[model samples]
Target: MPCGAQAQIIGYDQPDAEGGEGAAQAEPYKPSKRAGRGKGSRRLVVQPYIEVNQVVTAELSPGDDVLTYTEVAAGIDAGISGQRNAVSASVRYERRIGWSDRASDGDAISGIVRGYATVVPGVTIEAGGLATQVNVENGGSALAGGLFDGDSRTNVYSIYGGPSVATRAGDVNINANYRAGFTKVEHSDAFVATPGGAASDVFDKSVVQVADVEAGVAPYDVLPVGLAVAGSFYQEDISNLDQRVRDMQARAMVTVPVSRTVQAVGAIGYEDVEISSRDALRDADGDPVVGSNGRFVTDKSAPRQIAYDVDGLIWDVAVMWRPSRRTSLSAHVGRRYGTTSYGGTLAYAPNDRSQFSVSVYDNVAGFGGHLNRLIDELPDDFEAVRDPITGDLRGCVSSLEGSNCLAGALGSVRSATFRAPGIAASYSRRIGLMNAGIGAGYDRRKFIAAEGTILASANGVIDENYWLAAYISGALGRDAGWSANAYANWLSSSDPLVGDVSGYGVTAAYYRLLTQRLRATAAVGIDGATRDDPAINDIWTASALVGLRYNF
Candidate 1:
């Protein structure tokens, strides 16, 4: 029998490759609905556009300067939905021409793409990519809007691709998945102000790989209770300090049906996790060597030292409940990585006009691994949110399922391995002709470093981050509309030099259709940032934009 047919019979959904405490369980398959498309049909929409805008910015604090510029941009918004594939992408290129030398001029390319393609009856290909620009302060903090000076701007890129297989062998279901990802930070000059001196250890680049396989039988298929065996592997190689992390695990799971709407699950696993890195190069004076790019020079000849190593048995018990078609909940408490871990996910859709979702997660990884996992979780159908003034990705996507936000993952770019525990929630609703949504999250990281190394000072350090984003849009009659968005972020580090940082921004835009193919827009926004360090002054800027777009 085919996998799809077996899935329908046994109620076994696709296995989650990224295994953790809050793994997904067996559930009925739900088909997504595409606008103006029938079952098993194909549809594609592509819109090419050209835009021109006049922008002005004024520094509100620490200086009195007004700058003016003109922007020319070209972009395409495309989406395709078919029986075997689904894709959505938006790409844009913009050139800025300044009226004066001090106004700053440059070119930027920003975009996002995510999709999946079915290769065969039981195999599929999944891929995603992201490119955006951010302002990095000297204290290792990132600001959302890029209206600041050019010297503080940097670009970030990440891409991941993988293949997944799902099949059935008689009464047993088999599934497997593999993924490889690359992430890079370009022009990063951030540093930490230490009491001894300044330390430059920002994230540079990394490659991450993950794989998982599982074979199982549903309850009552061959026995009274379900049984399964699974194995997984994860690894990440960081260019900074030549750091590496590897984790391997194998487990056996059982499922017991408590009732028609609930089930109890238990799993016992053995896991081996290790983190290792080489020391930085040292000079004759016993000082670490610094490269021209303001980062520590890795000592290739030095032997790798173990930072963290744990090997032991892990166990967890979980509950899965589905009371209705619109409500589902899954939760688990486990012991892994030599510690207690707990996580869960809850989704509730009271009606067609509203949705609510919440998730809690715990993991140990570098910057690249966390980013890749978040991108992989995004839905295939979504609207990319962008800043109105700078046209940069806002770290979030709008969709009917819920707002998928990445603000927590992008909070810090430090080049150290840490254990992260976080929670995120989102709510979206349609009130008459208006649509509104809000997303909020909190993240905490505890650093881990080997003793007797240059990075020993960072050991046991903790950093906390909080972020919120909200947006609302409504129609202003037939061919006109308005939208507003606001965001805020807060960071607190145990290191005194890094201290605390906070930032907030808001933007509103109005558009009107003048003809069948032409549209006019006007927008205004203000962004501000503050740091606890007295030496670093506060920054505030206000910007305005007037633009026209032609669709082809």
Candidate 2:
């Protein structure tokens, strides 16, 4: 029910608490929960809503065209909660068919499903899936922050499911799980050629299959705090590209209480990872190049296909402190992903009415695979449809397809890997009938080349990026409200084709209750981006819309 105008800020760091992928979500003011509300023994709730909007858009730059269009959207939401089971789902479809120009017209279907079932007292089955398409920067998408048609778009879909079991053997608590999943990424056709000369559509597609299993056991009463040992193995097979990766890890973990208000955890482990790809060499005329070994020669100059393996001792330590009931601090340091990494989180409540948090992290991952892992960690709450820190929806959550999905998936495409490290902080509070928040962060991404990529080069594609954002929302009255958000992003890449770039976005929305189940809305948004690359021209875009929604 919390839908409104949204703007993605361009930034140098990961804008979310986890320092993960995707743009940040605006932290709108949240009203306090009404008092005396109680949960029903067994509850099921369903609602349906529809909206129609007339939008007008304008562009900056010479020979630009102004445009107008109508958007129609409909969706349903449902949730069921019981003593041993929980399920929630939402589905929505939207269409925008321009009255004149059809270049930017299309339809989108997005949804999420999450459920958990307890077959026995100590065993559970969990499943979920999500699909979404949105205009975003990076990831081989059409709407990238470049000079060409700035109205680009990308679509992503994924599904995963699995079962978990936990039981006690004497004083040891044991748990295990298995998961499988699939993911697909697609983008609109290119409006212009990339630096490598291939169309944007080449980096536009990928399909991956993932599977993994993990187990752990701990004997808490035997030690001051607790101790455990865990191990996991995962594999990934990619299509539309030639890449296969296998990974495994085993570790001994322990937690200890330092004081009444402080605690710490540490882990020591060994990891084994293997990455391989098929990159066939071709003759000048495009025929396969024969090698002395009677096998196709791998074209290393195009993209390295030789198998690469890395494994070593791994360890990490983390500490958590809660000096007071309303404040907490946590810090983590580890060595993983072929590098040393660290992260921490701090949360404080200045008063009963306001809260602030800061977080920082560093890690490396396959981009597409990391996105799936993020989805795997989503909360089961029905309204937790989108990432609160980053505006990205849980696109791939099909529980039916795999368990512990995303355990081995890598990069959104099979063409590259990313070592991402970043930090972010934000504060939010409510005063009377109004709520507001502000946040900022910086992220640096280093792309490592992979096989079967059509990109000119991967190492310098998307480099340092940073951003800042602010938003405010307040209740107009008992049944009305208004909100506004603004953000700016800057990018500096080593890639000549995508030099320094900057962008900004602003959006505002107001809604009025027409009835108990109906509402009217109006919104306006402006977004623009510029690049220092001489070959690319700067572009700006604006849009305004009026619409209505009804809830069942």
Candidate 3:
């Protein structure tokens, strides 16, 4: 996909991509009504294609030899759209064959699917799943995938779905949802290293469940501001570690129209959080260590819980402005996660052909909490599309899918229940036939294991991550095109058990229309990573490909 299409696939609400940011401002919750009769058989379409590429791998570190390989891949995509239902899905399979005896053959399967339907007048059903590889240093891509090997990639997949109901009680809008999902980490290990440099890999796997409920009543409309009382409850359960967390809040919310192009929202409330988990900690000799306080002595090298339960006051305030069709600014500041938290987004379109955005975020969450947030933001029934490359949902607000377009541009993430804060910025522009985009961001997270019950310890630690990405594409003519992308990422953790690492990669490709339904392509890419710890080796790999794709 082109840079512009990449932005659209990820659901970024850019000025030229989606008519502008005016389509992204927040709106009061309201029950969705059944769709009326419409024309055209709910738009439905299907596409299938096949491709082949020759790849070569090169290592920059000592004692490694260069290797070459060939890969064959095929995929299919389908989408549905209409007044009452929306759906999108795709699947791809690739096989890598090596020419050298030292290199092993492998295969990968990846895709994403999401859809929603109004089952009845006030009820909606929705589900979504993402299957992709996780790179050791750069996380993973939802579309154009990263390199895969024992050193750089692991398979991970997440799937979730549920039913939701929205109804009006007088002027109050009530909404509730119940969703269950599983996050599977296969053929992977969480390597733990002690202070002494001894390391071990423990299999990491788990199941997740989430539920939420909220209701709000708008009582006044005569003033420039509107008032509403809202209450919400959210809970998450992680089966592998036998952990559960809950959050509840009740707040008075106000929405103000500062002017024709400016708006503000404020909320104040009481919030509470609770967590529970099983206790099990052991010493080097395999003996349980008990603290003087009669709890298990937590180990710094192992997962430890924190007493995060909080019951207190919380407030949030935000403002949004679109002074012109080419510019937008929105920001929120508040007390959350038992701490002061803030986030914001700024978007500017200097002309008809370019758009830019920046975003900042801070929050505390339970296991699978991020996934829950994605599900919660979805409307009862809405039209949506996933990035054709990464297979990630574009978003849930109008065609924008909420402010999450910002998150998608920055790159998605994975974390155990924890508190995190981060910021990212991205810009995309098209000059004549050439298009480009760039993005960068950083994040820090403190994990929560278990609190008090033998799991609480003073050894709590945090993980920090930084990343940058860029892409450029241009047309050679109506029948031919070319594109290139580059990305880099670094990760560091306070815990001695986790290693610090950095990685960089680049890819370039050119293609031409061979026939009405066929195209020819050539591409090359590089992947490299290095670990700060001497025990972990540094490596580099490269690949090139020539392929023919047939589409129908």
Candidate 4:
């Protein structure tokens, strides 16, 4: 099965996996406006505590292949502090012993077992997670997750279970959510990735994508003008691309009851994109190629893709004014007029905390995205997964239609929209009885990119670029017991189709409550980040952790 490669099995007759084929589901990856590794609040006390850490650094990390002595659970106490929401879960796995993508070499196993539901005041729900990832004989380049080689390496089977529903309707607040899932890839043969970039092609069946979702919403009382509606969807089917997606959003507000405090807000959305196919082809070493039957095109194989039929629709609108209680004014407009995308964001708030804002965006009118070079070199190495018959770079003319692509950097992104302006503020009081808060923000952006190397008959690489960022956060103590928190962030980019990155880090933590079910805790942090975007990239990293707990 590894002597020359040849096995085809890619399915998707409308079985979407956010790969496209709409109805709903495709938006629930919002865990990172902050949270790469943040352990800000802690509480535990009832008995038993043991947690440890040591991952001094990683010079070249290509998206977590961890466990070089990753030191696990170590132990656990109970829970209580920061208002005890006691629940626990653990389960893990992995294994990759060589060329795990130019050498991250790995075999990985994920772990999570859950049970936590004690943050009571009125309404609270607890949910846990479980996962499993494998790479036993990985030679890398399964077309970077489009999967063409799913056995003897790269087998990620996952199971996510859940239960979450917070309550409060009288005061205006409600919540509900659900997640269901499955991912399987087994190939005794069949892999493809080579159109000029010799070597690196394997596919023996894969293309089933689905990540589930269910939702409910309610929130309204004014303040910033609140009222929201929700819907979600997701799917997965490696290589052959059995995709799925679905989305829904809603909003409304009013306080300008003729200046009764000055408030007016609005929101609107509609999304539908579909793509289904189970007659897949891209057997390469065996030549099944086919995508619209033009003799194979679309970055030329191994998930480079070129099969479209995901209906599209997107829209947005906004307005706000609070002419002084302290001071306030806002304006925002957004739209994807089906690929004519527009943009907006502007703000000012004088009190009730503090505020300032300015922004412009239009992620490629139609959200046009057909990326490669491993998602623009995600951390490094993978000219379409190596050896593609000698580093093909997607059947080049130097991509971007060859000629070294770079199409005048798409005129530095003039109309595709992507502008930036920002300002933000936050404040909280209770210095003596303890309980404080502080925040800051800054933004700047201008970009429209699409360089090359995914085979457009070669030619056309280096689209457009420009970017910038800044951030900060703080916390104090005493809402009932103890507290402390801190944060920092910075980012950069000025073209090269967006490259150049920045980094900053800081964190602190502590909490206590020893009775009513016992609660006690402790924490510490020092994080890191740095990105140059592209070309001769540079890297610097850091990490640290500590733990102790017990409660309820």
The order of the candidates by lDDT, greatest first, is 1, 3, 2, 4
Going through the candidates in the order shown, the clash numbers are 0, 33, 9, 110
> Candidates ranked by TM-score, best first?
1, 3, 2, 4
Best candidate according to lDDT? 1
Indicate whether candidate 1 or candidate 4 has the larger TM-score.
1
User: CA lDDT of each candidate?
Assistant: 0.75, 0.53, 0.55, 0.27
User: Across residues 194-255, which tens digit of lDDT does each residue of candidate 3 receive?
Assistant: 33222222213345444444456532434445666655555666543345666777777677
| TM-score pick, better of 3 and 4 | 3
- Per-residue C-alpha lDDT of model 1 across residues 162-253, encoded as one tens digit per residue: 77777789988777777899998785453746533636367889999887777888888898788888777788899988988788888888
Worst-scoring 10-residue span by lDDT in model 1: 1-10
Residue 138, candidate 3: how far off, in angstroms?
14
Q: Which stretches of candidate 4 lie over 4 Å from their true place?
A: 1-84, 91-110, 113-129, 133-244, 247-273, 276-286, 289-552
lDDT of candidate 3 at residue 331, scale 0 to 100: 75
433 in model 1: Cα distance from truth in Å? 3.6
**TM-score of structure candidate 2:** 0.73
Model 3 clashing residue pairs (backbone)? 56-542, 142-390, 143-389, 143-390, 305-450, 395-401, 396-401, 397-401, 397-402
What is the Å distance of residue 127 in model 1 from its true position? 0.7
